[model samples]
Target: QPRHSKRQPEWHQRDQDELVVNQPESATLDESQKPAYADQDSGSNKRKTRGIQQENAKDTVVLSKEISEDSKLAADKAMEAMGANILTELKEVQTNLKKQITDQSGLITKEMSEFRKEMGKRLDDIVADLKDVKNRVEEAEQRITEVEEFNMDVKDVLSHTLQLQEDLQTRLTDLEARSRRNNIRIHGVTKGEEGDNLQKFIENFIKTELSLTDTTLGIQRCHRPLGPKPPSGSNPRSIVIHFLEYTMKELVLRSAWGKKVIQLKEKRVFFDQDFPSDILAKRKAYNPIRKILKEKGLRFQTMYPSRLRVFYQNGPVIYNSAQDVSDDMRKRNMFEAAGKPTEDASQPKPGAFSWEGASGIQRWTRETRVKHIQEKLRAFKHNDNTL
Candidate 1:
């Protein structure tokens, strides 16, 4: 019977779902603390243990009291030990959970730092690109300004050269007529003095405009006549404009100043005010003045545009004489003057007649033309009386 009743074969361990189902709050307290309705069957286990202990007592009433005291002390000790074990388990679980939270916080901090650094690098690259663009824009603006100044200079040169051409033509005619009266040609009437004066004027203009030091511009000129054989030494001269792009470089002849080249110094400031390019653009839509300006240097001299046919194309002097001055006469004049006459196919033939439009007749507008009239009007400005 004792073998069969041995704890009923421990039903909590054998043939059971022994996994931790619930850590109930009630399980924290002792099962013995409950009263079980104060009934005999309900409290049988505790009562049986007490009665067996009492029967095993072998001393008198005083001895039995001492033994019951010892039993109560042992039960109190067991309960205290169980409470300590439960507290230790709770502390271990709490420590592990706190460690996990700290590790997660560290990982998040590291990721955030890496992301911040990456963003900073990208922003730096963007700022550098913006700086480069700004520099290019500044450079482009500077180049445009240089081109504008060069264009203005070309305009002035064209006007001045035209005036010179007219003056030379008028003087040549007077000299030729005087020589004809004598029936003997007057030689040695070269334009050396005038050519030097024109070159000096160019240098002074550049100096005045730039206010620069160590700057010098040299110009040379020669002239020729366009006609049949007039004489061996009667060809006109040309006014050549030359400059040095750099100090050590070869002299650059500025035959035709185009807008595509000419840049400002590296450190100079850009244009302080807007240029006339915008106005030119508008005018060019209906009237391409630029084309005329480029094609024709300056059709000067006569009151009508048709007279422009008598001017030089590439040379300074245009020899417009009476018809029948054959090629033999022109060659003789070219040699007497010791000048080589270059034939320009673009020039009009001798005695060729044609109807020229507004481009042929209009001199400078009335306003700009006044300067020419005034030069002749001024007394004592020149020794000659061509006016």
Candidate 2:
């Protein structure tokens, strides 16, 4: 409820009036004109400031472009100056490198030439030395070959000489065997013709012993003769024994009067010497034993005591003969035994059969005349079952 009266305070009123300032109409118009003037002045000042800024901007742009151009020009000039200096230094270094290469090439060429000359001299000397060595070796090899050939020749000669000697020895052996023509030999490991020879000796010994008729043994109580013939048939008979090689034979002979035992070979021997009974150079044997037996009164002519005469030798006993071998006529007096004349031949004195005849037999048994005949047949025809 506010009243519009004049009783209000003067300040309130004054505030209102001042806020709504009530002046004369002309004065109000005049104040409004003053603001227009101030606005024009501000507008003018702003335009002037804007114009100055545009001019400063244009000037700064022009100066920046000019400085950029100047800096480019300076850089181009510096590049040109550095290029000339670098070219000059490069030329100087190229000249120095060429001189050094030339100097090194010359030194290497000179060294190569010297080395070639030295090597050529050394190679020539080596080649000459090798040639001399090869020549000497060839000469030595030739000498060695000659020596080898000579040694082979000497060996061949010695071999030929040895073969000749062997041939000669073989020939000598053949000649010795040929000289004895059908002549009987009495020898062997223990007996030879001596085998049959010893047989005859035994018979002769028996005949002498039994002919005494003084022994208590009966005439038929002994062994018989191994001869091919009978003891008696009213005729003289011969006993043949052919032993061309080894004769390991034995004979048992006898008669009604006595017994004859003959051992042809008991040991082996040569034609010129006695028999050997062992594998020794020499040894005591039966001959010595026989000698001792004779000393003890045992009668064995082959022993040293019996002293057999060749005239009565029934075996080819190696004994002294009763006749004189020097006198040819007296030596062959066989006819004188039967009261007949003696005959002679124009043969040499040593070529007589003085070594043969009489009853050349040895007996080991005494059998009847008929029995003796049967035994010979038995020996010849009888088959030995033991074989």
Candidate 3:
């Protein structure tokens, strides 16, 4: 039912007819010269021409087969050549890639080595620094330990020194008090009352004023304390009397105390035992307590070297320091009657014995002792260094 072109078959038939008509003259005679057997000859000639055409067709088929085989061989050879070229190019590319990979690997390995070395060096430096710091810290700790030990030794030395100083001071005070034992101080006498003969004047004055019948009063020496003469209207300096006999001195002092109120030239006079300036300061600190005792009608006696003996209704109590007496008065609830302690009683004079310890020795305050120790230590260390 579909229409197809028939021009190919027509062209093939026409080509076959032309091939028969174009045959050579040797193969076919002219029609005019043919015998009466032309029909048979023509049949035979057609058979021969057909045979030749068959052989030519066979040869053409063989030639076409050979050409197809040759063309396949050529095409196979060309494909093989092209494959070889592509293989060579692939090998070159592979070689280049391998070289690049090798180069990159080497570079990477070299860089890694450098990085490792640098890190190792930095780590070493850090380790060294840590070691240095540790050593310094250890040294500082050692120094601190030494310093603490030195401070302890210094404290021990200072404590011993303070004890020795206290002992020295006690001995000195005792010596001074002993020196002043037999001396008596007379006050309220006008200046220059003894005139030229000091001993004669004192002997006559004591017998007359003190009512001493003993005319043979043994006297060693007598004089005013070394100082400038007092101006007019001022209280005269006391007369210090040194007697040869201690008993006679005691007798004279007792007589003066018994008199209570002695007058000379219309002026009231007083007598007291001569004491060192330091002991006097310590004794004077008791004035406030003495006044309180007097006001309260309590009898008390002052002992040698700054001591107080209170005669209470219950019993007699002795105190070594004014602070102790004040404390006792406070305990007895008698301090309020006198108000607060006077400055002299509360604050002691410098270089004055304020309080006595259980050992009967006086001590400086803790702060004062430490400060002195530090100064001494500094001086000692400086001396040692200089040596």
TM-score of each: 0.21, 0.33, 0.55
lDDT of 2 by residue, 225-334 (tens): 24344334332222322323222111111232124232223322222212211101111223333343344443434322223322233433333221222132235453
lDDT of 1 by residue, 1-387 (tens): 122222322433332233234323443456676455434443564575476446434323544465567667777888888889998988998998899879988988898999889989989999999899999999998998998687657545655665686687557645644332211111222344335465454355334434433545432321233323334566433222323332211222221121223222332211111112222122223222223323445343321111122234554332232121124225435323333323322223333333334457523333224334544434223332332
Tens-digit lDDT track for model 3 on 1-387?
A: 112222233545676787678765544777876677777766886897798678667766766666677777878999999999999999999999999999999999999999999999999999999999999999999999999889778766766686676678678878987887888998998876778987888888888878896656788889889865566899999999898888888988898899898887889989999987667767888898899999889999999878999999999999988888877788889977677567553243355553466688897654345445655666665665575
Sort the predicted structures by lDDT, highest score first: 3, 2, 1
Better of 2 and 3 by TM-score: 3
What lDDT does each candidate get? Answer: 0.41, 0.42, 0.79
On the 0 to 100 scale, the lDDT of residue 16 in model 3 is 72
Q: Indicate the residue-level lDDT of 137 in model 3.
A: 98
Q: Give the TM-score of candidate 2.
A: 0.33
For lDDT, the strongest prediction is 3
